[model samples]
Target: MSELDHASDPVVGASSRRDLFKLAGAGVGLAAAAALPLVPATAFAATPRFRLGEPEPAFILDPDVLYMNIGTTGSTPKYILKQFNDDNREVATNPTQSFGGVTPFRTLAAPGFGAELEEFVISYNTTDGMNKILAGVELNSGDEIITTNHEHPGGNGPMNLLLQRRGVKITRVNLPVGNNQKAQDYVDLFKAAITNKTKAFVFSAPTYLTGTMLPYKRLAKLAQKNGIMTIVDGAHATGMFNLDFQQTGIDFWGCSGHKWQCGPGGTGVLYIRNRVTKANPLPLFNFWPTNTNNSTLIEPRTNANAETYNIGTAVQSIGNPNYPMLKAFAECCTFWDSIGRGVIEKHDLTLSLYLKQKIASVWSVDNLYSPKDDPELLSALTSFSPFHTSSASVALGQAATDETAQSTTFVTRMREEYGIVIRNTAVPVIGSPAPHHPMRISTHLFHSARDVDRLVRSMKDLASRMDAGA
Candidate 1:
């Protein structure tokens, strides 16, 4: 096949691997193709050029611990760490003034994420980004913001602040779980919930609890149809997905630089849609910079044709910023660009699917909180009930304090005995009194089928022993 042909091929294409996986996960007659191992050992041996675990050496993770908790945070790459140390040393030796704002860093990092220089801002992690986004947007009393019940505290905290301060009403949609759900189901739910008072759609792309990648583009389009705004908490998407701000159709996106991007802590990327596009052609909403020194200079875009002011520069020019950490964060984006975001996304999702399949084989599919059959809902994070046989346990009110204790013990023993670092989340089961605590695992570029297999085997054995009351 020619290079272009390879790029467009559904089965072996470099750019179409996600589509291929989507078809496979949806059971669209690619069963034999989906069963094949990822790269090198499969029919797609020659294509994609990137292999699973090829970037393992780039990270300085301890060999003893199988760290599968990228959903919470990620380990910085070795070269980036060295560069971060060097930059810090230089800054310490000579006092550096950041009068120009981090425009140069944003310039280097924005294109890789499909964002313009005027839209991308380097902030302090997802929480800071969420605060900036929520505080900047113009909202009034009685205006309603639609979001999901599975939101992390990062997004929830800011929305709560808006509620107390501005009297904005928060409406949360109860999210559905498991393999049976589709992306359209979420869109329909949100559409049904929207009222005349709805002002914005605030939601997480991949919710931290269940790892379901809510359809941001569809939701954004829905928001646009109602002349509202969309603010996405893309905490787990910045480094996990090949993101395009324009195509995503979101008005504001707050993401983490430390999670999947593996940059220094307290660093993040915030994108503000400064111009209108075909995807979201609604006039830009009125915004005021909350965490900026140049508030007087920044003006919200009023028309669809041009940007009135540099919103990124306004939000990024807070006081004397951490220059070294921001520089390292920019360098991390460059490194991800060098590796190709599509390649990383493919590897991460491939491992995630493999792990999901393994868990389904051993425990059946009913216990999973994360969706697997719908590829649009798939993310690098997978969450499942290790102790329960079915989600019906929730309806029976069985996910109680004892189950929470067992889940905590499972996490502790996974790290202590098996040397694997993973986390457990309290997933809210619809029609249940309390939330179900399930194990959540993150698959990234540093992992392979072998690592996934090891995780499955360890989890299976540990769950078996714990079930037998040993």
Candidate 2:
């Protein structure tokens, strides 16, 4: 469904659970789940005894359906939903008073991630954030961009646009797979791809496909050394990692709040380095506001720290912003802060590591597309082969993923039969002619060890069933 559908959702303004369910036929995503009945997805009761490193029941999800595909989107907790609903109604009552200007939100949000308010802005999503950064950059004809093959369309959309408009060349590094690869291998591939004409380095941190966490800090340093602009498609990294943007020395980064942050859809975070610091020595790139309320403006402003204009204001205050959505996103960030970002990241990674180890034990270590031992390459997403019979078939490369119906069939069955919601991503293996479609799962603060076990066991049973009597 579209954003318009969500905006018109009757359940979004529902005052009670009954009203929510009655209005619920909204869809399968988080926006719809808000109004759906709280059906327990697992056998575990929604008990009140809070334990250490366990999933919290702060949000109401359809218990009947086990949702593990958080990388796609997430279930917004009740507190955020309640605030969003209330704010929406309040805005309706007072339409003229524009609660714009993200300074307050930025101030509340930045410290948690070790950034300053001047460098942050609430964005529509990863796509919107990427658009903002790309629009600001003064790209020239014949300039080249370096990225990975694993990027989502959100990041690729802007790069592809640059390619079409400015005649800029685009190069992609075919990322390696499984436990054999290290963080250095990623840096090496990107370094080899860079040339004298390269103007920018952009890529997703933890790629959606194969869930590989590319070394961002090292890559950013590489870009800085080359005097090239860095744009990070950090869609899944925001809430999953305690990011120190300033420390990373990246020029720009964009992330989706709806995925791991558990914020509303159409909400995201964008970090743009505001001034020249020791972290980045290159002269500031001249940027003009594409969507701004200011009738008059300045250009090619100073990139130094003294009396600097808040670049965040120019980006954030463009047009009338969604006060409710932005407010909810701020609240979500606060929620993460209150719980401690470090604590949350630890829990998320721990769950993912557990699932990865379990998969290795059951399906063999080679089946994993995500790294296991190296903490640097790990993320909350775990991708692997569920086809027990054809697990070794991929060694022949393209034929395995191209011919196999296992990924599509297994994902469908998991949702329809097993009452679970997860996704499959196609990965471009080094020598493979066709992309290897691996089953992917996201472990978040809303899931538990039981949730992990259920997913693994259900996958095992279903894979056995689909194994053609192997």
Candidate 3:
């Protein structure tokens, strides 16, 4: 099918490359650009006056869909999309300068893109980047790394892989759900868990399940004291929150750009401190091992399996990355900076608090899993549970319940029956053993008070229907 036809088709979700290139082509041909159907594309370029009850920022995303689930995958604005297209076109037209030339495009990207190329910041998907950090580092057998129950399965699988393949030991530190425990309790627990055998410490900087911000500053100090290299699986920490990995003093960190950072898919960031340069031994691409005392020299000497985590030629030749998207993410950073961390934090909390209040007012709502309105603990995402319901009864088990299955049905019902696109978190719900909860929702810059109102209205309707046996 043609690109326009595909985009126009209700059955086909998200726009395609043909559509993206067509949009780019229009811009190149000034006459054609004016004719391309721009989806509220002008608002992005103009300075929007932030007014109460004003329509939320609509960034070339599908206006037909109420995408409250920015946490899952962010919607890139047209300005950024245009930049990506232009960059890609430039690469296609001038391969020598763009990819093969002395001034390679990727090299330009290294300065501002993410972690510097000289550093261990390799660009890959979330799991790919995490695997690089996990595989590159040396872990002595029987060394222990402390983690938590509240993590995505992507993270869980990797930790387990390390344990199964490398003889590393994982110590899970469980945090209390809801009001069961305070934030300091978690910090103390992690500190208490550390032992001489602890080589690395890993945890989600922000607890994925509850969006509870972990005390990284405090934890970093502790990790440093114990001489344990810290690897934080901060998939959700990037876009939704401001991060200064250097300031955090952690040895290594990995995060996805799509979640809150709103960068395109297959984009992520990894950071390794300069201190780890000499101390931390990383695997090499085409690594050759040597009997030399120097760790850096050992990679050249050891040649068994050096190609494991290298970006290699496979990723290097994929043309210049969606330059516009990278530019857009930089713009998103600019946008975040202008809004100020305090304001963004306040905006997210306002929506979450509003949702929490609405849910609390409902007769059937039982437990709200998000942090209790504390700015230090809260984030853009919230997960909650509905009590006195048939679905909840069937799903909740003594050990753990599959929040993914339950939330899928709820969110699907919300979207198909109503017009909402909330996310279902795969992070273990507070007080639950499993790594998923029945319902999870995300609020972003695009979401407005009205959207929250719509959610509140639908939730009340759902509760009433359930109560009435419908």
Candidate 4:
């Protein structure tokens, strides 16, 4: 059957994608997809039990525009916003000192993320966390760290800094895109690059550019087998996925609280594996507290059975803290807990799946930058080239500048004319002379099937007009 025919198939039709997503917003299928071991089962739920757009009232976004850029940043929920405001006022009025390293907030928020109180640190942001992880990890000269080419500046910056400061060798695996890829494909790519010199595996989960959710558990397992530390740029995973740090066997994770988590800006969650896990029975690697005030109080874990120090406390105690913002961030975690992360993830992924199906129906799957067929690769972010019928058409080196301009125009028109807020990304297509510019859309709990329909309609109309030189 044709791609369009398949997308509209009654078994997983447009109506079911929309209606089932709405109804299942509460909690229907928490079982993980058999194919995608890391993802929660609700992601594949055929029938949902709650309303899709019921959480719209929780956020205080601009009504004039449909904000679909949560991949970059999320709007704070109304209740959290109020708490942030009240906390700020109280802090300003009382003039208190933040000597305890935001322990109260960390204590309340750590368990939800599958982290111990001493393992979680409230960071300034993902960049801050990434920097701390890279700087603190004991990478000596000639030590190798394997990463991906599609990595954001957040991950790239720290890795690059390591190259300059510590003389660490960086290896990048070119990621494969589109419907034909599988989760194991990523593991195989990373596995091939591993060597005795390799000390760590660093990459993003649900890369911001293509919105591909890399199989973390599989990758972590691969790293663990090789006796390598795993450092994750989880900017999009914190609020989007119901992640368990210990379960994933990651040594270090830095995720943005402001993005999918809907917390205040400059707030993030950093997880450090201070104890041994079944996945990684090796002793913890030696790490220093580079960005902390209590460096003397922290030490590397030597035992596989117990933590050597409170790494979170050492890292989080960087002078006076942003009390109000951290408090608000903690409250935001509570808010997500109340709604259930699995339910939110199911809704978000369902909307994205609906959007991808619609885009495939019109543009064909060949133009998609994000994988649609692989459940493990699915994420709330969907990216595609609207102007081209196939990605291969833009593989030639000469179209990069034109494609970028066209993508920017598409994004601007989508926001200015259609009242939809989305962003475009420069994707590095394999074998291409230059990057392919594709627009990205973020689907979250507040979005619905109707929203996806509207976006597709607007995209179709806008692309048609742009093609006609209007």
Residue runs of model 3 more than 4 Å from their true location after superposition: 1-58, 97-122, 275-335, 338-342, 363-366, 388-406, 426-436
Instruction: Give per-residue lDDT, candidate 4, residue 396.
Output: 54
Sorted by TM-score (best first), the order is 1, 4, 2, 3
lDDT of 3 by residue, 1-470 (tens): 10111223222112332343344341133233223332232322234533212223426656666777766777665555667677667767875433333123334433332333433343555676566667667775797878887766667787888799988899988765552345677779898898888877778767666667676766777776677677788787776655655556666777776776666666766564432322233322221111112232222323222323333222322344554444445555555444443334434544555565566556333466665434456556766765322123233564344444445667777788777787655544444334545466887655665677688788668646654766
Give the 10-residue window scoring lowest on summed lDDT in candidate 2.
1-10
Model 2 whole-model lDDT (C-alpha atoms) = 0.75
Residues forming the 10-long window of minimal summed lDDT in candidate 3? 1-10
- lDDT per residue, candidate 1, 1-470, as tens digits? 11111233333324444474754454433342235434332323432433347444577788889999999998888878997888788778876744244778899899989899888998899999999999989988999999989998999998998899999999999998777799999999999999999999999989999899998888888888899899999999999999988778899999999999988999999999988888778998888888888848554476675677888888888788888888888988988786677767776777787778877778888878898877788899999987784355553344487788899999999999999999999888787777888899999877876787789899999999998997
Arranged by lDDT with the best first, the candidates are 1, 4, 2, 3
Best by TM-score: 1
Q: Who is ahead in lDDT, 2 or 3?
A: 2
Span of ten consecutive residues with least summed lDDT in model 1:
1-10
Residue 27 lDDT in model 1?
A: 43
- Give residue 124's lDDT in candidate 3 (0 to 100): 52
Show model 4 residue runs off by greater than 4 Å: 1-52, 97-101, 295-297, 393-398
Q: Which wins on TM-score, candidate 2 or candidate 3?
A: 2
lDDT of 2 by residue, 1-470 (tens): 11111233222110321233233331223233223222222212222322223434577778788898989998787767987998898889997644554567778777877677878888899999998888788777888899988889998898899899888899998888887778889889989998999999889988999777888878878888888889999999998887888778888989898989989999998888877777776667666667567665655567575426777777787777787888888888887776556555655665677677778777877888888667678888998887632134354545664445768888999999999999988787776666777888998877766687789899999888877653
Point out the higher-scoring one by lDDT: 1 or 2.
1
